[model samples]
Target chain A: DQQVKQNSPSLSVQEGRISILNCDYTNSMFDYFLWYKKYPAEGPTFLISISSIKDKNEDGRFTVFLNKSAKHLSLHIVPSQPGDSAVYFCAASLSYNTDKLIFGTGTRLQVFP
Target chain B: DVKVTQSSRYLVKRTGEKVFLECVQDMDHENMFWYRQDPGLGLRLIYFSYDVKMKEKGDIPEGYSVSREKKERFSLILESASTNQTSMYLCASSSVTRVSYEQYFGPGTRLTVT
Candidate 1:
């Protein structure tokens, strides 16, 4: 079973608009969540993260909201730019060690001018 | 800055051949991981090590082995290459620091087993 899932394979948004990417998980033990961005040929880079203790975490143009009761989390990029186009992955970790992270299939976001 | 380097950016090997993929991290992280990314399947962990000479199998560790001889280096080995194993391999490292346990990844090596 997939512990983390990104149901949407792809998404498109116009520049300067808000882009929201969603992720869901079935494992209730997950206490930490992260978002990663990947470009072709490059490894994933950590975009943002949220602890289970908090409902939301914001960093500049990017924000990650976690709803533990719903087993859902979303990444929002405001004023989406052409440069923001890439594959986004959601990852979860149950503890600080041992099994480590479980990643989603990812969503390819395209920003149009 | 943290940097993780892979042995190759791209590699092609024939079936039944022994293959080796190397990864090195500059951050002195205690934990290192190897994952294979495939279409629709996402990144599945092949193996990971938390200390020298210690290794753990991830979700899919079949036909694969790993070596962590030193603190900064981790190697993934394929006993015999197969076409089904053709995919992008990524290496990552993270510390057990009190700040965070977020993993940092390498540039990735695209392996094509023919």
Candidate 2:
């Protein structure tokens, strides 16, 4: 069984709009969640993260919201830019030393100029 | 700055050949991971190392083995390459933390077993 899941395979939005990507998990043990962005050949880069203790975490243009009761989390990128076009992955870990992270299938987000 | 370096950006090997993929991280993080990314399966962890000489199998470890000889290096080995093993391999490293788990990845190595 998949502990983490991203149901959407792809998403498209206009530049300067808000782009929301959803992720769901079945394991309640997960306490830390992270979002990663990947370009074609380069590796994934950490975009933003949210801890289970908090409902939300925000960066400059990116925000991650966690709803523990719903077993759901989402990443929102405001004022989406053409440079934001890439694959996004959501991952979850139970705790600190839980060096292992369960990742979703990833969502390809395209920003149209 | 944290940097993870992979041995190769592209590797081509024949079936039944022994294959090795090496990764090095300069961040001195306690955790290092190896994952394979495919079209539909996303990123699947094959192995990870928490410290020197300490390793653990990830979700999918079959047909693969890993070694962490030194603190900054992690290696993934395929005893005998198989066609099915062809995929993009990514290596990542992260500091041990409770609330935040951020991993730094290397430029992936695309491996093809012919």
**Total colliding residue pairs, candidate 2:** 0
Across residues A1-113, which tens digit of lDDT does each residue of candidate 2 receive? 88899999999999999999999999999998999999999999989988899999999999999999999999999989999999999999886546678899999999999
lDDT of 1 by residue, A1-113 (tens): 99999999999999999999999999988999999999999999999999999999999999999999999999999989999999999999996453499999999999999
Write out the backbone clash pairs for model 1: none
DockQ of each: 0.73, 0.82
Per-residue lDDT tens digits for candidate 1, residues B1-114, read 989999999999999999999999999898999999998888999999989999999999999999999999999999999999999999999987736648999999999999
| Chain B TM-score, one value per candidate, order as shown | 0.98, 0.96
For candidate 1, the docking band is medium
lDDT score at residue B70, model 1, on the 0-100 scale: 98
Fraction of native Cα-Cα interface contacts (under 8 Å, chains A and B) also present in model 2: 0.77
TM-score of chain B of 1: 0.98
lDDT of 2 by residue, B1-114 (tens): 779999999999999999999999998888999999998789999999898999988888999999999989999999999999999999999887634577889999999999
**Residue B56 CA displacement from its true place in model 1, Å:** 0.4
